[model samples]
Target: MKSKVKPLPAEQKEEIATSEPLPAYASEEGIDPELLETARVRLELLYGEVAADWPGFIARPGQYQMMQAALLTFLSAKAPEDADRSGRQLAQLEAGTGTGKTVAYCLAAIVASEILKKPVVVSTATVALQEQLFQKDLPRLAKIIPDLRFDILKGRARYVCQSRLEGVINDVAQDMLPGDMFQDAFIDTRRQQEVIPRDRGQAMRWFKSTEKKLNNGSWDGDVDSLAQTPDPQDWRQVQANAHACNGGRCEFFKSCAFFKARRQAAGATLQVANHALILATLQNESTLIDAGNTLFVFDEAHHLPSIAAEQFSYRARIGTSSKLLTSLRTVALRHGKTLPASTRPDPVAFAQLITGCTDKLSVLERFWIDAGLVSAEKDVHRFTQGEIPQDLIPECEELANLLGSVNRTVERIAEALMEQDESLSVSERDEQTRAGVELGVYVSRLGTLEKLMRSWATHDKIPWAKWLEWVEDAGGTNIDAWLCASPMTAAQVLSKNLWKTVSAAVCTSATLTACGSFDFFDRMSGMNRFPERRSLVVDSPFDYATQGELRIAPMKHSPKNSEFSGELCLKLPGLLLAHEHGQLVLFTSRKQMQACHAALPAALEKQVLMQGVLSRVELLKEHSRRVKQGERSIIFGLQSFGEGIDLPGELCEHVVIDKLPFTPPNSPVEEALSEWLGTQGRDPFLELSVPRTGMKLAQWAGRGVRTVTDRAVITICDTRLISMRYGQALLDGMPPFPVVRPRA
Candidate 1:
């Protein structure tokens, strides 16, 4: 079949082709005043149209302020002429709930993008928010701003590769077993893949139906667009992946769904993406969109630091690597057969390297288990101060060198197979494609292992947290050990990869500050390094003082006491009965929440819904349903439910917090950071734990009074709120709710 991909529109083509010079107003004052006036006029027009179209719309002063802040920050983007300059056009906005931040950023970003001839990329922390923007907000905005163009940016794995789909379909139709000589070599991860389907007929039917939908244009070829969710293992067989893609070389290149989406995003004035996708595409300039020239608006921006840290982390499993190396040896030899003798890769040379690495891995795994560093009782073993054992450093260096050589050899073979060729037959081309895809997997795996080994071999000034965690199967059988390494902080990573490149960026969230300050956030996010950046704090529309009250309950024991959970069991029932409406209980630990739930009376238990019992969406829906029917409903959730949840008006009339939400230095990264701070004579408790906990507490308290009409009570059972010195700081971070506490 011929490719039926359509070309970009004439204006979009022109927009990409043209390279207009920056406007003359590139100075400390910001953009040209006339261009700024034009944006202001458009915004006023939008507000007028919205007010006329919706009778219920009530404009708020805070929303207007937020809009203005966004407008100026975005308009302050550095021009292409100043791309090599040091200063950045950045803004950190802490817009309270109900500030309408989404509309504010969208309208301002669109105007700035047009004025600057740059794309606006809005990234959110959660899929729920991303969906809300794409499905509801942007579509509505497009109706008002007639010519607005936008697209959602998803990872390649979310789309189907037509070449892979066709190959699988042909293999099934021919009755060829999976993993046979003629089969495609692009295997999914061995951990989850069931290569051969148990029910082959059913699998074939689903694949054929999916292919039909793609052909008929009923579906956009997005996995999320399907009416029914396909089995994960089955979906992996045809999922588009970077390791297997051949760009324009494949016959399906023009009609490819993933590439088509990329093209649309390239032409779009606004693109909605998640934090993970935005960070992942930074290293590769041509992926989703160029970070260097685009204007970025990060919604829920507090998550960026942690998300960036996770993205830069590396992990590899011991047992999995061993099996992967064996497979790589076979794949390299097979793919190298078609290359010229002089240029062909030597399988024996790489095989020896792979063997040495595997042997060293086995030795290390045995040594750890024998030393009780990691066993059944203890799954994790973090190196103290991010330092590996001196005795094992030499072995790690040897393994690093071995893996590095193996990766280089595999990469050579893959490059040879993937090279463009117009003289080959159809079957020969298919074979070459399969060979390239298979070798590509080994190359990626070897690269990860090589990086991991190198990290473990040396200790740097900016330390990386190194650790080992054992993986267990369903039956509690030890399967493998994962060696992991991550940067202690994301500050340097963001400073180098993100903050320095983007034309301008606006990082906004409802809870960007802790204890009336952005100090904690600035240091963690690397924003403190830029002195010229601006910040603003916008108040919520809700009247917290009149609409809600903070209640510090009398407790027999502090939350740090072992008897706290028991006290919660005794006090919670009465609180639930007194409310006689929607209520939410936020707990810091799962074990404590479960214990409190088990102790509830039958009537109270029947009225309650726990977090793990149902999906978050379903749980919130059911809570809303019961509240609407005038029935009492309570939700028991952990820290996750503290934020990113909506329960306006009567849906949540009271919120009960079991204790202060303070996380210990549990993870390797946190441990290393805490240790380093302690050595520097800094109090980690005050510098790290308090600020983070204050942010979480504020989020939990904010859930109680969500609207101006809401009359709710926030109950904190922890005695620390009144007894500890840090209590005032935590209280200052929350909304200005009236206090109703027991007499001292």
Candidate 2:
């Protein structure tokens, strides 16, 4: 196979080559022509108003083109009544930085949702972007359309649970009975140990202050909304969680903070969420949003595949799980004693079930140890092609059945404890509620182990990666073995779950294409399965030829050489000193960043700020403060600082990338994916690494030029940009910056 290097698209095309004509049903029936015409008129009016009246608005052709393309793709969607019809209602939109992509998609999705009579759900990959949409972009659009309403819905763990908070404030300050075995068992079974504040007086005061704020409506019960960041351990004790939630049965359900937000989300025209929450809803973990009747706009859509894969994977520990079962059994017996005779769970029967599970688990652990599957020398043992030893299947099946039975018995015990008993004292009621929540947590853990065991017991058509990892203590001593399994790819999963059922969707990102094509994203995101899916790439309006230049620093060693860090340190100082303002030095690895930082001169080191020393937000703030004070500042960061950092004008006048971000197949899932691809006679490096590296390079280079008048320079320390054959392909994926090469 030959390498094909496609140059960056210079302008937007009228029609995407891959987009097919709308299906006959969408064109001839089930759509109201009057409604579409009204929507089009409203969209045009809004765009015109923004162009004329909005402050700091630039007249960019790319934004308009993107808006038109997005609107058309959405208009081609099949209505809810025609969901089973043969039509794909997805638009793969890639808008470059500074293209106003968020506003473009929001307007399009909102209008289409009105016409289709479905709610719009926009999912982002990061909280910052989600905040920008809800707090910044949508508010501006809402002014244009007065009726526009949107709400942000995060995971349940973000809010405070009033019930838990009251219990913590009331009970934690008092003494407990001395010889209470049930109490000891509940404490042991908890995943998070109780946190004892160092200053109990100050802690109690803070808790009272927070409770008062919740009562006075000054605080919304969201940790993020707090003026001061609460201690994470303290927050975990009172945070809203699935295990602790009794839903409508709770005394505070009417005013529950998480439920209040969910109720608002149900009524809002648009709901903003993150990728993990959306995938969690698909997995039936929670029902926060209705996927079937919702139109979605996924921003930063490139992250969907990895997030989906992680959401579906399962893991369990052998030793820890055995101990947890024993503790759960004890808690179950104690709680059974508290319930009435008629409603009480059968403690003897439940104990027998748990004992069977523990017995099978012990046998499995012995099999792993005796069969030499896990040892001190090896930390990870992955099954080839996801196939485990034939002898282990029967044991897995037996354990799965026993665990399932035990899991059901635990659920029954939890429900029995949930029943309200009028005769119980206040302390007894509190203990019962707390015990039920712990049992709920155990039920969840047992369900996870059962799923992993079932996956091991039976084979599926889709490929999976099964592995055993030896868990070690901080002193490097082996403590337990972990069983893990994950699918090779999430493309098929997304296609079956989302694309086939969703009413309509648009996946947009700044760096979706690799090597000037959407083939990689299409395959990885499961969009390729829908041949009728439309795609459009809108170039940034900024004139990169004048605004920025790319310089390939001359190097004597390749990035793979041991001396490359030395080479990078030598080249970066002059570049940093010349800018004398905001400078970002991105490294692919922490080891390299440390090496380069240590080698810098004393004066330069004083001016440098490295990641992990301060939080990302504070680091950026400190750098900005120095730059605003007319002082030189250089930031040393890794992959996390590559894409989301926004420093325009004098804040960031130069960006120095140590080398290409080439991530090889290191994890079990990636290795299994590469192995599967290789068996089909494909080159994993070209298909996976190159394209992914291309996207990273594009994102890194984009940080250089943010606004129209802002000028900056991007310097690449690695020689591969000009020395390797595939380097040109990576270059073609980046902005059309003027290239400066070293003289021969």
Candidate 3:
């Protein structure tokens, strides 16, 4: 009997056929078959060269096929016009983690850009990946393909402003007074004093020494590396006194590291950058480096929408006004300037503005507090009716009026400062000017509150309440709150910005589809409506059935009870002891992680590594060393440890999750989102939470199996996996394995 290969799924076959097609222009030109074959041979030879140079690295089967598909899609889009007239096309490819996806994508992008006479923009989610591409992959590729061009573009904050550094040094030398009295008051506190010393001369000396070592030239312009910690006072001085950067106008523009890097990017065939900068470019229509003829490659593309939301979200706090007041006072006191008591700009007026805003915010907060109280007083069964107390309307109206008044006052002050004459001395005028700019920014943010108030009053989606609270900060306790209306979906806000406007886009990630369906990711990303768009889900080539085992431990009680963490802590030590170390125990909540850390036996505690207390790299290194030394150890981490962590062989033999990590429905933001989705007649449970949790569970499970030869056991202790209907979705998302029920 002959061995038989399994047939490809209908969907997979369609994806392969549709992903590529012969370029129309190439066909019109009647390109010779020999020439096309020669080009293909050259591409293979280039990849072979890379493999020969890197002794252990080899391209997996079908990797080239994926690359060809990516290239053909890109080239087809560019066939109609000159590079200048072609609109960029988006194509998503789903290649699993061990598929050498990065190299395949990079190779395809390079070839497509060259063939079509265009550039390629590659964007990724994390800096670690950015580093991997720039430091490891790109350089290796460049060595093999000598003509390839590439450059890395980081956000503006990554680079140090030469003028700003000089200004900070000068300000420290002059013993400049503190910018904010509130900050001055905290100077005596242990945290503040220890982090930022009082000796101005010493601080300046330290900065100068560090600056010299850097030679005032580093790509990305980040100042963090030069100092042990960021100093707010130093940053303020730098912002106020630094020379204006005119891009190409500066005398130092030629040797200027940032500009030099940008120039290099302009000439490169491929450019790598972060999501924020890329989105900002698209929103503003200003490509950092002319991408007129470029195909954008978005890596870890699932994060694009969330990152875009964060970029567009507005935030404001009570101390913004207080800080402005303090800065204004410092300038006035130094200039010996006194204005007429009635109409003159006084620092107290600014403070009063903040006080009035806080008072108004307090009213809104009280309304919510009373609402919570009323809900508590209602019959338990009546809670489902979703009625708002009629008494809260007047308070909401009054608070909205107060916020409006505060916004106007700030805007008026900003106008006066902007209209002021420029004849004043640098010290006399600069601080006030900056303060005015900041006030304008806040005035715009206050609009969010106004919008929230309107939505709440009208009950746009669902009945919800807005609230605020005074929270402690390093300066002092300050107010921050949600201008929240009942739960709203991020999809509602993101759909217009991300989904509708783009002519074409490709979203690729290792974990996008859940339970063999892309519906979950599509809904969350606001891409569900594009049913005609192409998608693919390629499985990891690693054989997980051989490399890993799934074990579900039986539990006697629910995980929701208060004593669950303690119980888990008690149960974990024996498991760790049996496994003989190299264990990673993940928890959904910080409180649980802390309780487990505290409850572990002293000997076990000594061998356990916990998150929050140490950096990720440090924790991983310590775990690796302990496992190498043959000591049993457990590493406890939260969501940060879920994905992107790779540990093969004995370094990881057991993976344990405390429970399913679901977004807490009570969280103000999530609650608002859920309520909004409910109003839209969508199943919030299946559409919003289940898929998100399922994706996370899959990511966490992936940490266990990294290589074909690796083997480990995964234990999900939560009883819900067996009891809940949605548990099947989570289980189906995982690699296929035989189920085993442990003896109670």
Candidate 4:
């Protein structure tokens, strides 16, 4: 197959390769008034056409207003030559669910991009939403607009690297077994990967099948295009890694799956990708696509801060270190044996260096576990404040010093593998190229270990929280521990890296405000840092007070009381029988959800569908199965089911919340965030904890009234909502629902 669009011209390609200046762009104030008005009129027509094309499309004022706002924001940044240069054209919008936010943003963004001569980049928080835009929304827009071109882009790992595919295929031809190789395992300490497979044959078959599928055009080399989810172990081995890529130099470069997709993305007018991929590609300043001069729409935009923090975070795992050392030995011998006598690296010297690093890491790992700093939980141990206790600072300091020497040796060895030699043939270079890829893995690992030890040795490091968490598998004595450090807040990182660069951006969600203010989101997103920005809150068209009622069921004991579990267990059986249609019972913890399930009678248990017993898909399917066939179905779910779940109409009619959702006090990330806030002379509980709980409560309640016609009753078993003073604020902050508290 051939590409329909021509590749970018050489000069255009060069611009994409280079980084642009980040100095503030031309202001919207200088733009011609007539031009802005003209753009607005055209966008209005496009939105109207979308509404007219769809049957029974009852236009809501909120949806229409959101579209206009998006158009204005995009146009506000259009100062011709210097436009998109502080990229301050930003808006924090709170468009409620069912407001048709997808169409509003998509239609407005596409039209504005065309007028401004820039690509439109729409990022979703989840793959499901990404697919909806790529397959459903974009295709619909393309039909109406004719020339509108869009493509879906994902992280590199989501694609099968053709180079890796060819290597595995050739390995089979040589009768090589995969049980030994890791497909050039790219060790990323920040993200955990599955262990290697036991059977080489299974991996060989998967690669061959995938290659065949791509050739026949049955699959697009996209992991999502597969009929079934591939096993994590097999998928991790074959997935593409940027660190392992040789770019245009690889033997399989012409047919590379990842780059092929990147090329396609560069040609499109609008590129839809998940948040993680967009963040990474932009930060790396890669030439894969034109990132700047694009309008970015972050749907489910609330998750941006935390996800960005994860990207900047570093980690060092115990077992991964062992694997690193093992690979070091394996690669040294394999490459040394192939090279000519004069150019070969010394295998004995490299072996000793690898052994020394391994032994030193083992000693450090033992010291962390044995020290009293770690607090054991269900399966893991966490350091409370990310602090390496007072007594262990000396040991940690020594580890940091030792790691510096190890890092230097690893860098030297990796470089030696890629060094050009006069005696080397083309074939030797190919072997050297492969060896260099393996060397990159250890070199990356050594860097992470060094950073972890350096941070751990420091005391009273605010914002930068350092800790070690060790997890022991059930019934397995050998445990895996990780040394981790992360910023408590992603504000600084986002404001500097992302917000400063894009031409214009719209950060939006169904719930972005708390207690009738955008202050929480503004501070969290670092949008407050920008001098000129706007915020909007579009109330849901649904009349929450008329459509739903929140009933506070009085309990004899508070949720934290010793007898509360038994009391909840006793109260649920009768309450379960009272609700008709489908019921979604939300819980704060899995243990409580299970405990309440155990208290139910066998008949009620038979009627209930639990989250853990089946796949979330199967659980919903079974619940639907029971509900439609004239049987009652109730879904018992935890935090995951609280938000981003839709069971509209009769699928879900009643919502039962057992207790208020709050972050665990000792959780590493939250604790660090709290500590950081205190140092800044701010009340951590009010700023961080309260807003989070309110958002979650709003999410739980939002589940009940998905549409204007939706009518349901929400019962809160905990009496704290009305009893405690702070709880009243949470209740007041929730969407306006009529209260039915008899006596508190």
Best by lDDT: 1
**lDDT, residue 311, model 3:** 52
| Displacement of the residue 659 alpha carbon in candidate 3, Å | 1.6
Superposed model 1: Cα runs more than 4 Å off: 1-38, 79-88, 171-205, 284-286, 359-363, 366-372, 420-423, 472-479
**Model 2 misplacement above 4 A:** 1-34, 78-87, 172-209, 338-343, 371-377, 421-434, 474-478, 578-580
- Estimate the TM-score of every prediction: 0.89, 0.89, 0.73, 0.84
Judge candidate 1 at residue 614 and give its lDDT: 100
Look at candidate 2 and tell me the lDDT of residue 95: 91
Q: Tens-digit lDDT track for model 2 on 328-380? A: 77767777787778867677787888888888789878877887877778778
Residue 362 alpha-carbon offset, candidate 3, angstroms: 12
Which portions of model 4 miss their true places by more than 4 Å? 1-31, 78-88, 172-198, 289-291, 318-372, 375-430, 443-447, 450-461, 471-480, 601-603, 679-681
- Expressed as tens digits, the lDDT of each residue in 1-744 for candidate 4 is 322221234464344224255212213454467877777667766766666565445676677667766776777653335534443478877898788888888877887887788888899988888998898877887776778889988888899877656666775212211232333222332245455544778877877888889778788788988998887766765678765566677777777778888888888988888888777776667655454577889999888887887766766666666566666567556655655566555677667666766776676667766663344454334454666566556655766666676566555554566565558788777666655554555555566666666767775545477666654544755466666777677777788777776777888888787655677777877787876676777657788878889988778999889898889999887877887668899998889999999989998888888898899998998888888887879999998998988888777888999998877656566677887677779999889877888888988888898887888888889888888877877886688889998573
lDDT of 1 by residue, 395-487 (tens): 889999988888888777777788755688877877787667655655655676787888898898878999988666548643667788888
* Tens-digit per-residue lDDT, 1-744, candidate 3: 322222234465456445446332112122244544544555555566665664466555545555655554454443323332222243456666677777777876676566557677788886668767877788878886889888887755455555446546655222323345333322213234344445787667766864575474442344434436456555444431112343443334565555666777778887888777776665545646444345767789877766765554432333343353344335433322322234345456545655655565566556544454322233111112133445555655664565676566556565555444457676545444444443444454455555445544555434433333233445645432223343234454445554444323456777777765777766666665544345555556777767777877766656877666667878877767778858888888898888878877898889888997789899899989988998876789999898888887787888988888887676445555666567778887887688888878888887777766777888888878777898888888876655555676
Task: Choose 2 or 3, whichever is better by lDDT.
Answer: 2
lDDT of each: 0.80, 0.79, 0.60, 0.72
Note the residue pairs that clash in candidate 4: 24-86, 25-85, 25-86
